[model samples]
Target: MSDATSPVPAAAPVARKVTSIGLGLLAVGGALSAWAFFDEDLRTRFGFGYMVGFTFAWAIVLGSLFFVALQHATASVWSVVLRRVAEMLASPMLILAVLYIPLLLVALLHPDSTIFPWRNPTSEMAEHAVHVKGSYLNETGFLVRTALFFSIWIFFTWFFVRGSLNQDGGRRADITERLRKFSGPFIILFAFTATFASFDWLMSLEPNWFSTIYGVYVFGGITLSALAAITLALSALKRSGLIAPELIRKDHLYSLGGLLFAFTCFWGYIAFSQYMLIWYANMPEETIYYTKRLSNGWAGVTVALAFVRFVIPFLFLLSRQVKTDERKLGMISIFILFGQLFDLYWLVMPNSFGEAGPGFGIPELGPVLFFCGVLLVAYGRFVRRHPVVAMGDPHFEASRGFRLH
Candidate 1:
């Protein structure tokens, strides 16, 4: 049981620091991203870069939402203390909904732009697979589907965050039961929405290339990246003395590390499975996706992604000592986040560059920094406004005693 009682401590001081940094990054990243759009000719290149930044950030946010849902559905006790942080991490889904508008405008206004070939299919593209997929890939369908995806996300986020907040500081535990009951259904909704969203946003980038498991592939990254992000946040709170050592124990930290290790493996497994299936089939349409990524300048990025995202973390996190050590685990969490960005960059950039190879510069950095700012500000604001721990949860006391056997 928890040694601490009743009213949970507030996180205002930490919130201020996080929000300040977030605002600064938001300004700079917003300015640079805006500058990239001025030159119409460069719009296609930078627009695609913007997609990379957006996806990199959104994956983490959406993944955090999944984490919250999973906790409630499984009634997991160990994560009760940490669930508030995950809830805060996920609160940014609304922000992403707004950020998505500009991209949608681009989709609506510049369909002919190289970013989406279906908008203005070329002579060769006209005869290819783009033709058959026209009904599903049209601009209107894209817009409607985007709306559906965001609606599902917003409703669930509100339900969980609001419900949890309402239950703060020894309130009725019935709300907990209510949340738990609905969590299973929320996850079912998450799977369908996340899968289709991946299909619409990322997979559609390469209309000709299709993967039945693409959504699963992105899900692996999303959950893995979300866990890494959560680990980083908890580590920061611990180091800053915002989260008392007693509230978040070494067992909790170890659990976080073990999750990171497991998901890294999961992501790697999905990645290899997708590639292996495609390779074995030797189908031109599917193979083209790997071909672009595997050859020339892009090849190095693929190799680097696998090593940094999987192999390095897999080996480093194996030791029990490393999982419990804040500094050591924090360092890898940072890298895992970077790997998530690089993985998205790898997925989105190659299509824009084609045989010219990978391109990275101001255009790429702008959107990334912009989304980073948005996330920081959102999370900070959430922490500032509410309790950092789920003190109202019936399971909160048991979570304090959570330990590995």
Candidate 2:
């Protein structure tokens, strides 16, 4: 469609430069990853580190996909201008699918890998607590579930993204009707897939410790972080003169900032709800999860998460001036993204590092850099070729002047 031959705005050359820089970073990250793969000592560390990086990127991708679907499902006119960027952000699903192969291979071949305790249960796992759960925690089940999860995610992501791109060229009003028709059903599917995927990829890390609300907790971080990513990207495009200020007005940015504030509150509520219920019940099964995190220097990371995820964004965005100011909002969005990385780190690292606490050495940095490259390259290449805004959308004109009442 338009992605192939559209005459992009003045941003093409800049997007090309970004692609080049991403390639360089990918090369560096790939080299370090190879070293870590071959080195026996760093192999397990590499696996865990890669999970951190993968989840961080995965949240953004899934979040973007959700945002685009939500707007279509709600027929939200105010967010129409922002939807294209969300689509671009979600474009890396296949890349993530490919990256997951190594982790899957480890589960299948290297059963002794420490990254997934379920794959190689210890003697302690013989206890009834962990043993009983072994029915769903088996190797074959994990592989089958992983395949199912990716299939659902890839199909839906491709459907929404491709439909949007086709609309940009075909200029068919019927396309919008078809997308809206499917949006509701897709969301229902999204909820189940996202929840079970979190359990499979992350919560199962400890095997014995679990939370009924863990999926909701992960969902909060995913949407909040993805919104922040979209805001920052749109801000960058505006600053570079690729998108005119009037097209994506200050009021529109304020609307985005408002959503950021709302989801921050949602995240705070879920984080508190999960922790409060577990603390109140004080069961050995549930308490074990928080106990490890609250001890051995992990407490500091938890505190930082509280501030970044909730308190800081909650207070700062309350100001009308701040919400509308590109510079101010951009800063908070950057912090939120870093907070998302730390949040995922908190979830994934404590399982491996344990009493030693969090580690941020080369093993960790390598994968972070690699995924960062993947995001930049994926975004830059897509925006360079495609129309940056959904100009053919029926509501394009209406969204240009949309404002919060």
On lDDT, the candidate that comes out on top is 1
Q: Cα-based RMSD of the predictions, in order?
A: 3.4, 2.0
TM-score of each: 0.95, 0.96
Colliding residue pairs in candidate 2 = none
Please, what are the lDDT tens digits per residue for candidate 1 over residues 1-405?
121321324466677789899999999999988888777766777788788888888888889889999999999999999898888888888889998988876645664566776766564566568989999988889999999999999999899999999988566789989999999999999999999999999999888889999999999989988999899998887777767778988999999999999999999999999999999999998899989998868889999999988899899999999999989999999999998998898889898788998888777889899999999998877776777778889998899999888
lDDT values, one for every candidate: 0.86, 0.85
